[model samples]
Target: MPYKLSATLSAHSADVRALSSPTNDLILSASRDSTAISWQRATDQPGFVPSNVLRPSSRYVNSITYIPPSADAPKGFVVTGSQDTIVNVFALDKAKDEPDFSLIGHTENVCALNATPNGTIVSGSWDKTAKVWKDFKLAHDLKGHQQSVWAVLAVDEDKVLTGSADKTIKLWQQHKAVHTYNGHQDAVRGLALITDIGFASCSNDSEIRVWTFGGDLVYTLSGHTSFVYSLSVLPNGDIVSGGEDRSVRIWRDGECTQTIVHPAISVWAVSTMPNGDVVSGCSDGIVRVFSTSEDRWASEADLKEYEDKVAGQALQAQQVGDIKKSDLPGPEALQIPGKKPGDVKMVKNGSIVEAHQWDSASGSWQKIGEVVDAVGQDRKQLYQGKEYDYVFDVDIQDGVPALKLPYNITENPYSAAQTFLQNNDLPLTYVDEVVRFIEKNTAGVNIGTGGNEYVDPFTGASRYQASTASTGTAPASAYMDPFTGASRYISGSGSTPSQAPSSAHMDPFTGASRYSGAASVPAPTTNILPVTQCNTFKQANVAAMQSKLHQFNEGLQNEISTSSLAMYPQEVTAIDEIFAYLGQTIATPPQQPSVTLTAAHVEAIIQVLSRWPTSQRFPVIDLSRILTGLCPRVLDAPGLKDRFFEALFKASDWSDPWSPPPPKPRETNILLLLRTLVNSFQERAGLEDGAWPTRVFESLSQAPYAVLTKTQRVALATVLFKFVFSTKPRAPRPF
Candidate 1:
């Protein structure tokens, strides 16, 4: 093959974080190992050579850029940003491995660096600001981002774009933000210039967005299932992106045309050589070059390496699955109620698929489904069950499942307590004490009645019966409170009976002492420490289970997965279902069937609208008709009309980091709707205050008006201002 492994530039002791090409044959690399190294091809040798290790300090060199020769530095410079929060400049023809000068200002790590065409260096830092440097001094301290600015791209002589953790892309001219575009839901980590009029951005949201120079969102390109860390525009106009998903994806016409998967967890940096070769810096510390030209392809040895790597992964996954299988409820374990053997169930914290066993009706068998789980995750215990799942899996603190019990309000308190103790797992030895505590506590008051059937809070099951009393007389002085691990007594009617003190009130739920006397009930003594330990262990497990469940759910839905056509297949499926449902709901002959959008439909709209115009294959109802015809009629319904507008507002937001703001077509559609809603509110003066106008106002407030041409922004602002003044609450007409 024409394209093969030419050389392995290895010197960094840690993962390579960034890469930049200074010339066709020269490359620069930054690493978490706290050094930046220069690489160049050797004419006399067979491979590339590395030299001049720029170890400015013991800090990770996160970003690097090349500065062109200028009056400040005739030899040009290699600029680097590090975790030390310093931006260091090194001479291009350095005689030794050291920075020429350091620009120190950022209070946090400098994560991104770029050199403008005008010989000014731009650096974005975790301090939430971007600084422009000219003549070796700070020129402009660009400050607008609410979070760390992770990416900065120089578009031309006067314009720059900064992507931030706040999920916004701000376009700056002469250090002032001209417009801010919002699309990504997570941190924007990478940006690339597409053309003079447009650009591309990628984010932790696991998607890419193309935007016009005016901040108009053109389209969203969704394919990566992980944080997109780096991007490069190929000579052929195709966009290449790499991320934590360990893949390099090639996008053409808003779809992923090719995907190059790596054997590492992250492909941190991607760049395109003038020769049409795509080079990537990976977390495995290897620099790989891929060719899209037909004349050259991966060599046989390279292909075999990939094959071996994949095979090894499969084997490792299988072994982990085996280990997880042991954690699943086996046939000997009890099965869920009414579930039988061979019935498929989500087990191992809902991650592993296991089937119930007939012979061992108690639990399930970890069989074939384990392979799917193994393939999906790298580590066995990396994720845990969700919070809701954990809550549903176990009983409450008393070790008593929520159950229905039958008892009469007038039934003897002692008898009711006995029945409860019998049904629950309380020790038989504590029966006398429990009955006495119940009798005195319930004196002159009935716990069980027609209206007082005890319900299990956890399971929501009602207890309908009272426990039968062991004897007709009170037996003991105290019983242990399950929640507080303290002994509770029946005030004046215990074994050590005395006149009941009116100063104390007992709380049955928590068993915490409530006293009005000068001395409160003494805190539980050290004698009860053993009970605390056991309870603490149980509570700790429950909490761990809850946290694990949430982590697992979030991780399971994460977009980072092995795929070429789509980033998160599950999210795509969900989005498709939303559209399908909406299409069926909204696709009717105009105003024929009482076309009312319900809470469900509104929720569905919320899910679909947030990522609108992308994957929006279904035809949408005209916004004018919906506002003029449908919305007014449905205003009386609870949260329906407001929800519709809220959905619209979300759809109109350009803040998503994955894609740009809605293009002019979609933007115009929203603008028209806003005008319609405002006019309608004016006609019905003081009718629906703040219902429609609130959403419109929010959209207008954050809209990138400066980015739009004067005419466009003016048209939008006029409609918004008209709506605001017209909707103001007016004085009552004089009678």
Candidate 2:
């Protein structure tokens, strides 16, 4: 996992034309994108963009060469060839704005170019000839191949190697063929001089063959699945070749020592630095330098297998029934002695639902289930057929949830009513002190489409409904299909309620309940102390979670500066997003959030959100229902901003505006998006920087804060949090 990616110099507008490694410290690349750029060395930060951009040709530049300038020649000239078929030699020390003279006469595209030690320029062209230039004038036309000469190499003034489409690599001495090797069945694409051996040739036959000056074939190495385009002879006599396979391979003593798959478009050229590392120029308009040091498949297989196993295990566990869906209980519903769940709404947004009694009593979202032992009331059998109107009812169905009513159709006919009973109707007793209020919401109660199981119509939770199942959750194929309005639930069979035998009710299935009697939900926990000064946080939530946060600088002294806390490009961008989501959630929660909300909290949240880009984008396709929802206009957004927007929304109440903070931005949902995108590209494209989308301007520009990853978000939050919470409160402003 410890890999280093260098962006280096990226001024090219097209595929890199050539590459050269004059020293181990620098990487040189010539690109048709109109410039030659250099990278110095490796570091933790991204490499800098090109310090300069230069155009070597008015048209396409085909090849370039560097001659360690000698005593008899000019000190600064670098030779270059073009598709225009002409050769131009320019000064490396000269500024890019000015043009120099040109060496002309090839009537077709120059495919390859090279320079001899003696200041002699050699270029091979599709014109089917190898031309040598001296003093900027064509001196000799080395002709032998019957087809286009594709590559040329000069070992010295007297010897040269020229490969061609004519299916041969010919050794020429003083402009005459000294030897010819023609065993290859396809076009010869490359040639390299072995110092001890005569020459080396690579062909479209996917083979590399070495030969002697006498035309005797020395050895043939084969491994490439496609054309071998370029090769370099090593000091140890090993050979490294680049081919159409997008790979670089090394052969030594008749064996392939290494093969590295790269992301460059077409592995067209290869070069080696003095340190023995390799550099490659590819057709995708890029040049890459890589270190060949570790075992290629060692971590890959282990990592892949590990990931697969983890995924499989998670699939099994998440599939277990988490809840069930059921239809709302009917009027005859009561404290049944035995009843299994039916199709009822149970799990909504991951939380189980509970019913509140319908105290024909206090009108409200009250508890609606049966009560425990009362004054001589055999509550269990006494209310077996009669509905209990004082308490609530609770049931879970098919990994879904629902709340049952307290009053069965018409005051459970089994009850004996007193003449002057208050709104409270528990047969004989009535308590009239507590007044509860409930919003008259008939939305989920109707029989329309049986309440689309896979979607939340009000908050737009259909967005998260993916074609696939959730990770660690059951596969869609394993359960009742929520998308089709169908979810699996259990139905009571073989016996009637109240008569299935009391032994079954003695050890009631849901173990969470500890009360003794006809099952009724114990009252909502008395642990709900009012959240006030007693609930003051150990750490002040000083910073406002939104854009343009107020600073939280007052408490810091010996603290580390967050500027460098986790300076990854990704973490930085996420700092601005987590708060953006928090601001959106307060606008709408599932059900009417608390009645305690005020316009001030609303305005503050809006003000904070306005400083960042909004996430309330338009819904898309059939997937829209789970992924998108109402665009909150409180300077607009939603009630929760987790990466799984739809899933969380279904769990929230559009009426209840309170929501839990999404898992920390640095660890979960928010930064996960950018992390996935970055990781996918790095894998699919190997190590080429050019594969990065130029349209993604921030990353292209090498901005440290452009990544939007998790770690950086945490660090950025540290800083932004201070700024948000540290602002001085202003006096009330006049209208």
Candidate 3:
């Protein structure tokens, strides 16, 4: 028989994001309310009751797991990962607010956690890395993922599996990645290990895939129509998955057997008990359990009330896909039987449109909700190619059309305002105005508790003041770039050309440009200091670069001597991820949860540049130029910046004496190297310490400025201009 609701437990005041069930009698839930609750059922009790609440973090507690009992913690420990980037462990026997052990190593939001039977814990974070903990101490740091690690599973004491927002799964043997499985087109959000098979993964692409340990994809289950966030395996080997579609689906033998819909916006997490019960945490702040045994099912009155809640929701047309109201049949269509369970059918009754779902258990169609037109009702708008919760039109001038400002509810308002200003080439001073406009328009509709304070991770700017008010009065003359802390260039005042730099220029990094008076002082005929703004070579055709890279790889594979130097499988995966990230960021409307490039990706580029033939190295060098411009944090390591630049110099023969009209390959390489250097001047591109920049300048001094081509000279000049303006005072030198 299909599963039916057995119990409903509600104590959280906010969305429940994660759930774990180690036994049939115990359940743990983590919520955005910053608390983790333990629910227990006595032998004579018919339902679970909240037994203890642990305030694990001040921010949202996103993930939770149970560790086996040890001598130190007789009743076992409750582990939690939160948005504050800390993983905390608390003993179940104690009711204190403070944790017994705090495992803090992640630098960003810790979103996933899992533990092995022997008490080894593995955690994944938005920091693009995972960590293993043993006996309350750091065991191994799992690195190499190029994006946020959203899902993690401990296969055993020595093996772990991590799924990432980069749309790939990696199997790690201790701290090293041994195998990468790539098939998902969107973020891989959930994973569950099968007994005999390798594992099953669920993704934002709305597909569940089963894979074997031999790296072969067994089959795919494709009934869910939205992002799948959590997965678990039953003792009988059936797969249970929950998703944004508000449905808990059960898969048996690679096919969807049933879908249990919830009365909430999202079913964020799901787990299976030691027996046969299923547990789910939902966005409605409720934890529900379902069982196949009729004796464990809830009372008839409670089931009816739950059904009414599901039927009361008002679903927009977009949620069910494009609805052609004219083409839909009338009420008579409900008389015909649906082919399978969970099949949705829309019918027009008189002038109203209704949504109905086929229930195999009841052998009838159940009215789930009413479908309404989605113009201004809960449906996301398509801005460029990406979907956004809101797209406002801002009229900057009387005669000009309003510019479109796209935003999502989950994004920080300051970040959205900055993106809007940058996209429209507007002045940074308008940031406050844009933010106020957004707050005024989006008031009361924002999700969660509105007054909670949040700190922007990128800029370290506070989003809300202590009085529960927006921080709109903060200075806007100097705004920091989110990725790089460099001061954004604000537009100059409308004064005469001969006027000195405006005192309104508050950014200490850029005092004033001597070239600010361009009209009064004739343009310099030679390369000079203090250019108005730094010019970066950032534009690129990512598809073309990727195609050329693969072409070169194929060429190397066909040759006898070069075959050994062909890109390694991991290197190829890294390169492909680089292009994917570039494509997403450069799209008309950039994708959310942006991928972060790691030192491993930089290492891959270095390997290709060092090993590929000279003629074939330009494409790789061009890719480096784009990577540095887009993700400068990849060079944040201790010696990675030095090594990366050294590879570029070696690839271009920068140390060799230059002759006029150099070889075509060498000339192309040098030009690309110069362009890459121009892109590397932004903040966090290893400019904190002046040693690397001095080395770069010293290398360029080897080539006489007079002998360089026009393109090379222009690139070199831009690099020098940026270095001079963006950094502290340094001795001047001629190139």
| Reference-based TM-score, model 3 | 0.65
| Predicted candidate 2 versus true structure: per-residue lDDT over 325-422, tens digit per residue | 24434333423321211111111222323322221211212222121111111111102111132222212222222223232211211121221122
- Pick the winner on lDDT between candidates 2 and 3: 3
TM-score of each: 0.46, 0.39, 0.65
Query: Against the true structure, candidate 3 has what lDDT?
Result: 0.77
List the candidate numbers ranked by lDDT, top first: 3, 1, 2
lDDT for residue 709 in candidate 2, whole number 0-100: 37
Question: What's the residue-level lDDT of 261 in candidate 2?
Answer: 45
Best by lDDT: 3
lDDT of 3 at 87: 96
Q: List, residue by residue over 1-735, the lDDT tens digit for candidate 3.
A: 889899999898777888999998899999888899999985677899888899988888989999978888888999999989999999998799999999989988888999987789999998777899998899998875656788999999999999988788988888767778999988888999999888999988889999996789999999887778899999999999998777999889987778898887578899999888999998677899999999999999999999998887666566688988899999999999888877899999888888998888778898888886442223235454233656665654322334688866566666798778765435676665555444434432323333332222111222222231222221233332322222332322221122223332222245543122111211224546655666567777788679767857764654445677789999999999999989897888877425567889999999988898787898899898888887777788989999999999999888777777677788778888988887788543767787888888888888977667666776788888777766865664331
TM-score-based ranking, best first?
A: 3, 1, 2
Clashing residue pairs in candidate 3 (N, C-alpha, C atoms within 3 angstroms): none
lDDT of each: 0.55, 0.44, 0.77
